[model samples]
Target: MSTYSSNQEQFMYQTIIKWITDDRWMMDILRNVRSLSLPDSWVCAGFVRSKIWDQLHQIEPRTPLTDIDVVYYDATDLDKKTEKVWEQQLSRIQPELPWSVKNEARMHIVNGIAPYDSTVDAISYFPETATALGVRLDEQDQLILVAPCGLTDVFEMNIRVNPHFLQGRGDMETYTQRIQQKNWQHTWDRLTVVDS
Candidate 1:
C-alpha cells in the first residue's frame, strides 16, 4: 500500500507506471464497454485534452499521459426519457474496471486548485502525465458528449477522447494569455514545491 504524501516521485515509481501498462486490466474495460453507449449530451475532460497540452508543451520536453480530466461541452443535455440507464451501463462494466465510479457530474469543474491550474480545471498539475479531455461520438461521426446515462443515482456516461477537437486550436490561447499576465516564473518561485 502507498502512503502518498509529498513524495510524488516515490508514488509514481511504485504506482502510476504499473497501472498505465496493465494491458489485461485495460482490455477488460475496453471489452465490457464495447457494447456500452455514449452520452450524446456530455463531453469528456481527460485524455484528448492531455494530448493537445502535450503537443504544446513538448517545447519543454515530451510529457507523458496519466490522469485524464473531462467535462461536458454543453452541460445540460440529458433529462427526459431515461430510466435506470446509467445503472444498466455501469453495472454491466463496473466489475471489469479497476477504478470505481463515483459522482457523475455533468461537468467536472476544474477550478484551478494550484500547481495544476494549467487549464480551467487545473489539469496540468498531474505529476507523471498530461491532463486529457474526452467526448462521445455518434455513429455518423457526430458528438454525443453530454447525454444522460443510467438512473439519477447511478448515471454514468461513457465518452471518447476527442483528438480532432484538441488538434484544431494548438496554442490554447485563452489559458496562455492568463498565464502570461500572471508571471508564472515568479509564481513558481513562491510555490512550496517546484521543479529545478
Candidate 2:
C-alpha cells in the first residue's frame, strides 16, 4: 500500500506544482539545481515559503525573492568552502539567479548547535515552522517536498516562530529580530503574525 500526503498537503503541493509549471524560470532553476546531484539536496527555505505566502496573499505570482537557498547534507565532507564552490557553479548555470548554497553537516558549528543529521533536520531548526520547508526535483523530474514542520502555518498565512527555536534565549531574540526585520505584514497584510 502506498501512503500519500494528507488531502490538504496534496492541495498545497499541487498549488506549488502548478505555480512552478506556469513559470519557465522556476522550472529551469529546479532542473539546474537538480543537475548538480549534491548529496541529499533540496532548494529550500524562502523558495518554498514565499511562494505559499504569495498564493495566500492572492497577489501576482511574481514575488521578488532575495535568495534561492539550496541546502544539502554530506557527512563525508564538512568543508565550508565547498558550499562556495556550489554557489559558483549555480551562478554559472544561471547568472541572474540569486543562489545561496549551504551544507548542513557543518552548519551546526555556525549555528552553535549540535550537528544536524540531514537537510530536513537542519530545516527544523529554522526560526519559523512555516519557513522550515523544502522542495526539489527528483531524477524522474518529479517535484518532491520535504516539509519537516508540516504545511499548516504556511497554508494558513500564520507567522509564528518554530518551537525548536524557542529553546534558546538567544534564538528567541534572533527570531523576534527576524520577524521585525522581515516585516512580511507590510506586504501580506492578511498574515496572522503571532510573536511570542
Candidate 3:
C-alpha cells in the first residue's frame, strides 16, 4: 500500500512546487545542488522541511540550516568514503553552504536496516514524516518534490515517527532520541510531536 493516496500526493506536490518556484533562494540552492551531477540526487530532508515550517510559522526563512542534506543513489559505488568526495564537490560549488552528501545505497548499514533501493526509499524511512521530503530540479529545470510520507504532518506542523522506522526496537529508540534532541517546539512554538 502507498503511504499517501493519489489526491493527497498531488496536493503535496503542488504545494511544494509553488513554494520552491516562488522562492529564489530555494531555486538557487536546488540549481547548485543539481550542478553536482550525482546520479538520482536530490536536496532533501530539512532542506525542504525547515522552509515549510518557517513559512507556516510566519517566521523568517533565514533560520540557519542544520545541514543541507544532498542525497543520491549510486549502487556501483557504495563506499561511505565517497560521500565525502561529493560533499567536497558540493562545497566547491557553494563554498559558504554547510553541505552534507549521503549515498543512500550504503546507508542501510549505518542505520542497521536493509539496503535502500533509491534516494526516495531512504527518505521514506527518515525519522520524521516532515523531514522525509526531497526536491530536485530536472534537466529542464522542472522542480520535482518526492514525499513518500506525504505533506499532512508538515502542513499541519506535526512531527511524527515514520512507520518504516517503527519496525525495529533500535530504530524506535533512535527516533525517540532524535525527537528529544531536536526540541523543535522550542523554536516553532506551534509544533506538535506525536510519538505514539
Error of 1 at 101 (Å): 5.3
**lDDT ranking, high to low:** 3, 2, 1
Off by over 4 Å in 1: 1-22, 39-88, 94-105, 108-196
**Which stretch of 10 consecutive residues in model 1 shows the poorest summed lDDT?**
147-156
lDDT of 2 at 119: 89
Q: TM-score for all predictions?
A: 0.27, 0.91, 0.91
CA RMSD per model (angstroms): 16.5, 2.6, 2.0
Q: Candidate 2 at 185: error in angstroms?
A: 1.0
Clashing pairs in 2: none
RMSD of 2: 2.6
- Candidate 2 is scored at a TM of 0.91
**Candidate 1 lDDT over residue span 159-184, tens digit each:** 22223223322233533453356342
> Tens digits of per-residue lDDT for model 2 on 1-196?
1122689877876777777666677778889999999989988988888877777777785688999999999988889889999999999989898899999998888878778888888888788878888888888888877767777788888898888766522367777888899998898888888765
Model 3 spans with C-alpha error above 4 angstroms? 1-9, 168-170
